[model samples]
Target: MDTMRERFVSTTSQLLDEDARLALVLAEISKDGFSAARRRHPDRVINVGIREQLLIGAGGGIALTGLRPIMHTFASFLVERPFEQVKLDFGHQGTGGVLVSAGASYDWPAGGFTHMAPGDVALLDTLDGWSVQVPGHPDEAEALLRQSAARDDRVYIRLSLQTNARAHASDGKPGFRTLREGRGGVVIAVGPMLDHVLAATEGLDVTVLYATTVRPFDSAALRAAAGVQNAADVVIVEPYLAGTSTAAASEALTDVPHRVLGLGVSRRELRRYGRMDEHLTAHGLDPRGLRARMARFLPGTPR
Candidate 1:
């Protein structure tokens, strides 16, 4: 399967070729992947090397100069490391760009803590007007990136190593997509967490909601998916930090009381180096772990 990172570079190159207003900025990480794009549009695709702050600053400068810039790099280095640049250069300065990040959460577990950034979205929540889309598959990633590149919004596209067996359209918009129907409650699956969510929720009496765009979170769609004003036992399974969307979910279900359980990379650091499965087990975010947690949270399920 083509990974999201590969598709991103490809689509970006294609977009840069087709659109004159598009520019791509990289920070040495994915520079090799974009060799062809850089060659085709040498001046547009700029790689500042290892300096994420300058990468974002150049993006902002390009945006200020009348071109939309798409910034790329690993998640931690892209968001957490040069966050001030993101804040001042992009946010405060009002320079808009499409920020695409790969290595979702702990996709690089062997790379250790410095490589992981589960709090990227949570930190993004502190800012305003940024669209966050987490695509579960490469096709979705391409589509989202394509769509965002066309517009001039402060957008963040998050790509990951994990993916589903198949790609889904789910309205082709940023909102709650109901894949399965039930009455127990709703399980909102974000980004690449869909596969695990599907496996875990099997045979359970609950509605499963899939979302590619979590920030600017579709509250109305979420409310509608629950089919009730007060959605009880609505679990949000994100690939990043746990409880990342609790506040948005709460505000969405404000009309009535609801119970929300946020599941994802836990706040606690394991302090041990391991693979993805090991991290999932530690965080209780794998299929088996999620199933056990759901059995307890979903009102009355057989133990």
Candidate 2:
């Protein structure tokens, strides 16, 4: 099974080839993989080499020059390490570009906190007019990339090693898609967390909503599924930081008072490193942990 990152490299290169107005920037991560594209579009495809700050700046500059740019690197380097550049170079300049990041949450457990970015999306939330897409599978990743590339808005596509076995995007359509139906409440799964969510809500009487796009939050669809009265208890399960979208959830349910339980990576960092499953288990994001925590919030879940 090829990872979402692999698919991004493959598809993005094709985008670089097809669209002369498209440019790519890399900060040394996966630079070897894009050698051919770099050769083909030497002026458009730039490798800044360990300068994360310059990476976004170059992309911003390229956008100003009337080209859609895609900048790539690890999540931490792409977001946290050079946040000022992202904020000013793009946001201040009013220049839009697509920031594609790999290494989801604690993707490289051995790489530890410095290499991890559980708060990447939350950080982007602070900025305005940015569209964030966290696709569950590779097919959805390609589709979302192509969609974002066609626009000039600030787009952040969070790629990960974590993936679902299948793509759940509604053809090429946008917004939330229902995976399972019930009235116990809605358990919204973000990106790679779909598999874990499906496992957690297996026999529960809750409507399971799967979404690849989280930035827009799809309030209209959410309200439609959960109802305006907000009688049903809501649960949001994401692959990134926990409770990152609680405010959005609350805002959407303004008409009715409802309860929301968010499941995701904890704020505390795990000092030791092992496998991805170990990190997930530590954060209570594994299926077993998810099932346990969600059962209490949902009620009547099979023990």
Candidate 3:
């Protein structure tokens, strides 16, 4: 099974072949993967060197010319580094393009904290009219990428090194998919956190909701799930910053009494450069850590 980034290169390359209106902009992040793509469509496949801002600027420029541009880069460089350009280039300009990001949170721990972007989604939340998709599997990533390419919308497809054991199919719509039903509260797992979440909540009577499309957050599904549960106690397990979607959850269940526990990467950075699994355990995202936390939050959960 190839990683999401590898699948992205192959899928986007095929997309370039299929769609004349589609263009890709990069900042030397995944240039090697797109070597053949560049050769095939030199005019469309752009590499703007190390300038992150220019990468977005170039994509936005292409969008103005009625071309659907897909900008690729590390999450930190793509969203955090060139945030101002992202805000102005795509949002302010009122143009549509796809921003595909890799190096999610701490995928490459050896690359140091500069490469991590746990707060990328939170930062984008401040902006308006951006559709965010966090695919847990390569197949989902390819599906979402192709879906985004077909439309001229301001879409952000977050690709991560972490993924679930299997892929969950979608109906080409944005919403959460309920994986398990229970009378106890609800657990919403986003992107790569599904498998861990499943393991953590095993034997616990709680509804498990899988979310790949976060923005335009499927409030209806959340409300519906909470409506039947014994308690509206919701826990959101994201692959990015903890509490990134807590506020959104609260808003979704504004009228109903509820409590939300957001879990993911901590704001307190781990000083030591360790393996990705080490980081997951440190952040309380592993199955053991998650079970402990979930047991405490949702009553009647077995310890």
Give Cα-based local distance difference scores for all models.
Answer: 0.88, 0.88, 0.94
lDDT digits (tens) for residues 124-184 of candidate 3: 9999999999999999998999999998789999999999999985444679999999878
User: Which digits, one per residue and each the tens of the lDDT, describe model 1 over residues 114-233?
Assistant: 889999999999998899999999999998988898888799999998888887752347777889988888899997899999999888888899899987989987788766535566
lDDT of 2 by residue, 1-303 (tens): 788899899999999988898999999999999999999989999999999999988898888999999999999999999999999989999998999999989989888778899999999999988889999899999999998888989999999989988998926467889888788788899998999889877888888899899988988777887883447578898999999988898889888768889888899978887888899889988789998898777767775
Worst 10 residues of 1 by lDDT: 224-233
Best by TM-score: 3
Question: How good is model 2 by TM-score?
Answer: 0.97
TM-scores for candidates 1 onward, in order: 0.97, 0.97, 0.98
lDDT leader: 3
**Clashes by residue pair, model 2:** none
> After aligning candidate 1 to the native by TM-score, how far in Å is the CA of 300 from where it should be?
0.7
* Clash pairs for candidate 1: none
